[model samples]
Every structure is written in structure tokens, then in C-alpha cells.
Target: MHLPSRRPLLTGTAVTALLLSLSACGGGAAADAKTGEYKLVQNGVITAATQSEQPPFAITDSAGRPTGFAVELMNEAAERLDLKVQYKTTTLQGILAGLSAGQYDIGVAGVGATAERKKSVAFTTPFYWGFTDVLTLKDGKQDALPDFDGKRVGAVSGSVQEDFVHREMGGANLVKFKDQTALITQLLSGGVEAAVLGGASADAYVAKEPVRIAVKLASLQGSAFPMRKNGDPRLLKDIDHQIDEMIDDGTYIRLYKKYFHDPIASDLIKERPKLAEQVMNHPDLAPSRR
Candidate 1:
């Protein structure tokens, strides 16, 4: 999943300028007095930002409409709240920077809700859990993380996988790309000997490309939607409530099955214990026994 950057995507003058521009475009607003709800950037609408190519989480379809697991969940929540969503596609960095600038009300693209990220943005309750995977050419001999040490390894710039490369494979020649599409492109063309991706995303690519997972790292924190820090208490609460309602009604599980075939992540049921019974009842959703 996309993790927070150790460095700010926008700082000082750039942020100030961006904020000023957003304000001029009617960016900020007061809470609604009648409903006690947070006033949206555009009344009755959610301005959401997401990366265009983070598969199974956020991706633009052939028709240019945004559609993916995260996007669908957000859409469902908005529908429940009687609100409309307007999506803008950009790099993951742009999504983070835009939220800080009040240019977007929310960001959804398989974002990991790490403590470092919470310092800048508040997150909705986690909706997905996944591992990290290392990918190499289908016939490549490298089957383990250590085998790639001292070789060129690529990851999306600012993603947790990049941090993994630095911390775990310190000897690697690390290459960073702006997005997953470019990362996979480089991996396929031999620009990098290996690439790290979110587990489900790697699976999506592997299904279609001549690549295979060389390593599967332990799961990380769950993925969630991000909003500006301390912004819109009501909206945050509402989104979380909607997510809970979805789970209770089996809507979340239905959507999970729509985009993923693997059993629901055990960590997810651990986090939301209510899902335990559902998983137990549905054989397909149950984790496989070793």
C-alpha cells in the first residue's frame, strides 16, 4: 500500500500558494449549522483525489472513469450520505499535497494508515489489509529478498516498499518511480532487477504480465481513506459509521469478493471482530489452512 513520505510533498511557499489558490476556488467552509455536519469543499459533494494506476485499489477504467475497490467503497459511502463524489486522478504525492491544500476532501488509493501519516492527516477506519511482495521477471532466479541485494530494485517513490528497500536491502541500488505503472514498466524492461509492490497489486500485475513474486513480506497496517488533519470531524465520523454499516450488512464482503479472490485477510477480521462470523460461514472467505 502507499505509505506516507518521510518528507513533505509540499512545504513552505508552495503550500501557502496552493492554499491561497484553493481558497480562491472556494476551498474552505464552515460547518452546517442545521445538521451539525462539516461543510464540504463543494456543498453536497466530495472532492476526492487518487492515483490513476494503483490497481485493485484505485484505477481509471478504459472509459476514463475512476473505478476500483477503494473508489467503489468511497462511492458507496457517499451514496449513503446523499453526497456526490468528484474524482481527480494524479500521482500519489499529488493526492497527499492536495488534501493538505484543501483542494481535496479525501484521498483513497490503498493508503496505509501509518502513525507517520496520521501526524498530517486523519484516516477513516481501515478497510483493507495486505502484505508486500517483491516481483521479478518470470524466469528470473532470484527467489528471495537477499538475492536482490546489490542489484537495482525499484519501488514507487515515497511508498513503504521504498523504505523497505533502504532498511532491509541497504546494498541495493534503489530506483524510485512516480507511480506503479512506471515501476512495472521499468521492471519489465530490465531497468531494475526487482521491484516491490503491495501484495494484491503485485498479484494483479503478475496475472497479466510475465513477472512472478520473488518474495512475500509480512502484512503491514491496513489501508484507509485520508483527510486533512483535524478536518471535518462530522465527515470522518460519518465515513467510519458508513464503513461499519457496510460490514454489518455484508456489503463490504460482497465488494471484497468482487475485486479479490483470495480469502479475506485474517488481520482484517482481527481488527473488526464482527467479520469473524461472516468469514466462518462463507467457505470462500475463510483463510486457507496450512
Candidate 2:
């Protein structure tokens, strides 16, 4: 999951000032008086923020439009709601901060639904779940988590991988990059001995780069859409409902197959038993036998 950066606690006034500064480029939406639903930033538009380079989840296509699993899911959800989306690309930090400041209606760049994040923003039902991977040069000797201790490791700034490095590899020299692209680049360039990434993202990079996954960690908390807390409960409910509908109707699985060839993560199915039934009833969707 793309986790938020560790930041110093802000004073009440400082937080308000920061939100004001961060929101200068956009206007906040007001709630609909009659329905108590959150109004769109624009009359019929959902202002969304996503990462430009978190591939397989969020990426800019050749034509420069936001198009990836997460983005497409949100786009479909918006369409079902009869709304259009205007996307802005930014770092994961920007996505979270923007949501908090009311600068964006939704954030969809593979964000993890972590407890710490729930304090300031709301998350829809998680749509995806997977593991974390440690990536190293094809010839690098590091083959396990402990092997990387005291070595230089890279992770996207404000990402869960960053948190992992801090918590698990306490003695490692942690190098933080602005995004996955930079982290992978630094790994390949020998700027860092290894890099940590989301499982699917690591697979995407390993397919095209000269890196290999040396370690695959346990499943991470699921990825979900983040919205400003206390902004609009109705909107949150609507999105969660749409996600459930998609999962039930197989729209979610169809999109999942489009980007990922691996079997559905077992933990995901465990959390959503209905999805497990779907896989069981359809052999084609079943996980490969080990």
C-alpha cells in the first residue's frame, strides 16, 4: 500500500494554516442542504488525485491520462453515479493531504487502509490486497529481510514500504524516493542496494527491469479509496455500495485479471467470503495449485 509519510504533529492552528495553503489551488465542496450529501467540487465532477507512476494501480497512459486498476475502478464507480472525474497527479503525500484539506474528493493511488490514516480521512471498503516485496539487482546477494540490515534500501517516500523499512530493518540506511519509478531507478543504478515495493508493483518492475524479488512479506492491509473524514457520509456509503456491487457482479474480478495474472490473494478472499465462493464456483478464477 502507498502509505503516508511520517510527519511531525501539527498544532491546531498550524494544521489549519497548512490545509489552507495546500488547498489554495482548489475549492472545497459544500454539502447538499436537502440531502445532506456531499456536493461535488464542480457541479457534476469528482476531483480525484492519483500518482502518475504507481503502475498496475495508478499510471499515466501514453496519452497522459490517468489509467490503471484503481483509477479505472473509480472511473466506473463515478460513471455509475452519473458523475465525471477530473484527475490530478501527485505524490501519495499530496493525495492524502489534499483529501484532508478538501482539495480532492477522492484519492486513488493504491492507498492502504491503515488505522493511523483513518483518523483524518475515510476509506471505502478495500478493493485490493497483496504482499510487500524486497527487490534487488538480479545478481545481488541479499535474499532475505535480515540480509538487508545495515544496507542501503530504497522505498517511496510516504509509503508503507518506507514504514516497513523503519520497523523491520532498523539498522538499514533507508533511502526514500518520491515515487516507485525513482526508487526502482535508484535500485538499478546502484544508488541503493535494494528497494521495497508492493507485490504487484514489484512484479511489474521485475518484468521490465533487471531486478528480482528477494523477499515477499506477508499480505498487507488492503488498498482503498480515501476521502476526507466527516465530509459526507452519504458519499462514502454510496462508494462502498458500488464497490460491493462490482465485486458481486464480477466487474472487480474482470478488472483484476486485466492487470494481474496471479491468483487472487488468499487473504482477500478470506476477508470477503463471497469472493471465495465466486472463485470456487468458477474454476477459471481459482488460484493455481502450488
Candidate 3:
């Protein structure tokens, strides 16, 4: 969770130059008068960006195609909008910048919405809530977050947990990795005493490794798709509408079970009631349920 730098808005000369380059390559943003939707980079294709290897969230399968919770959710939204999606993988740190530069139409890499993040890109209503957790090798020297004080701790270079490490555990030596797997590997190998990760990423590692959650950090608001600020209205609306539909029709819960191998509960919504209510207004998740 590194605090993002001030990002230049996705307008003016930079956007114009990027669009011109895309048009020369046979693709560019063009608004369709009839449907009121922006033509994507590739005709009929929504250019999506994601970080590779973030487990149950976004990962490349054996076929070298993106397949995971986030990717599948993006696919579902595109399907509802009658658009095809082509995924491009990059380091986690690059996803938002790419979107801001107009290099991607949408980004779905389990991005959590934060005030810092909102400056770089527009976030859709959150589709899933995530918790931040600390991980260490089972029976290792570290048993709690405090154990890492003034010691090395690993975090995905640009993730929210990395920001947590910096702000809350300022005395700890921060070691940043390009991906969560690498961060976990460092912790397992004793390169670091503990690592901070999203709860799901920690779960994925603990399933096969000798690791245990040291503690759960404060939960995040939720994960959402990141788009260029002031991007296509129809595209944003379609994605948001699809998310609302998923919650009402139970597709969101099904996807949660499929990826988490467990059930989705209203507890997630309860954890951040006001934020969730404002962003995700599905009737199925009423305040009474919380």
C-alpha cells in the first residue's frame, strides 16, 4: 500500500497523443452515436489491464490466459455489454498508470479504492471486499505484527498493505516485491520476518506453504475496476449496473465461493457500511441484513 504520487489527469496533450497512436495502430477511442458507448481500442474489444499472479483474484492459468475472480468479473461485465475483452498483464504498480495514460480501457487487478487511488483513476462500485493480513512462516520467529518492528517485512510494491507497513509499522524495514507470491517467498525463506498481503493472497499461500496469518489488519472498503477519470459514461454505467445485478442475482456470492472456496457474508458489507451502501446499492444487501 504505497501512497501513490500525484498523477496528472488523463486529459489534454497526453491523452490526445495516446489516442492518435492507438488510431494509427488500427484502434482508438471513438464514441458510437447510436449506442452512446465508446468504441474500444480494438473494434469490439475492451482493452483490459491486470497484474499477473495475484491468485484467486487475477492470475494466468496454464493456458497463459488470465483466469481468476477479477478477470472473470471483467469478462462478465463485457459480456453483458456485448464487448469482447483482451487482457494485458503488467506489474501491479503499473496498472493504474496505464489506465491514466489511456493505455487500457479498464483495469481489474483487485484494486482497492482509497483517497490516494481515486486521484489516479475512477473506481467503479466495489465488487468484493478484502481484508489486509500479515503472514509469517508457521513456527517462525515472527508471531505478531509487533514482532516485525525494526525488522524486515515484505509487501507487494504498490499494494495497500505496503502503505500500511509504511504508515503503521514505520520502524520496520520494508522490502517490496513485484508480486505477492514473491513477497510470501521472501517471508518463507527468512528474507523477511513477516509480510503483509491481502487476505486472499495470504490464503492462497497458506494452502500450500507453512505459513500462518499473524494478524488481520483493518479490512479494506472493497475492490473495484479502475478506469480513466471522466472515461466513457456508458462503459462506466454498464460495469456498475452489472455489479449491482451480480449482487441482486447472487452471481457475486457464487463467484466468491468459487474463488474463496467459502461463502460470502454480509459481514463484509457491515465492516464498511456507509461506503458499501453508497457504492453498492443492491437491494439484496440491505442495512437490515448487516
For model 3, the superposed segments whose C-alpha errors exceed 4 Å read 1-36, 261-290
Residue pairs in steric clash, candidate 1? none
Candidate 3 weakest ten by summed lDDT = 1-10
TM-score of each: 0.85, 0.84, 0.78
lDDT of 1 by residue, 1-290 (tens): 22222233444454334434433443233233233446678877888998889989999999999999999999998888878899989888788888888888999789888877787788887888877888999999887667887899999987878878988788889999999999999999999999988888998999999998888765568888999774677888788777767776899889998888776665566555556556655757764333
Residue-wise C-alpha lDDT for candidate 2, range 16-135, written one tens digit per residue? 343344334223332332323356666667889999999799999999899999998999888777678899999999999999888988898799888889998999877788778888
lDDT-wise, the better of 2 and 3 is 2
User: What TM-score does structure 3 among the candidates reach?
Assistant: 0.78
RMSD of 1: 12.4
Give the poorly placed runs of model 2, Cα more than 4 Å off.
1-37, 284-290
| C-alpha lDDT of all candidate models, in order | 0.79, 0.77, 0.70
TM for candidate 1 is 0.85
Ranking by lDDT: 1, 2, 3
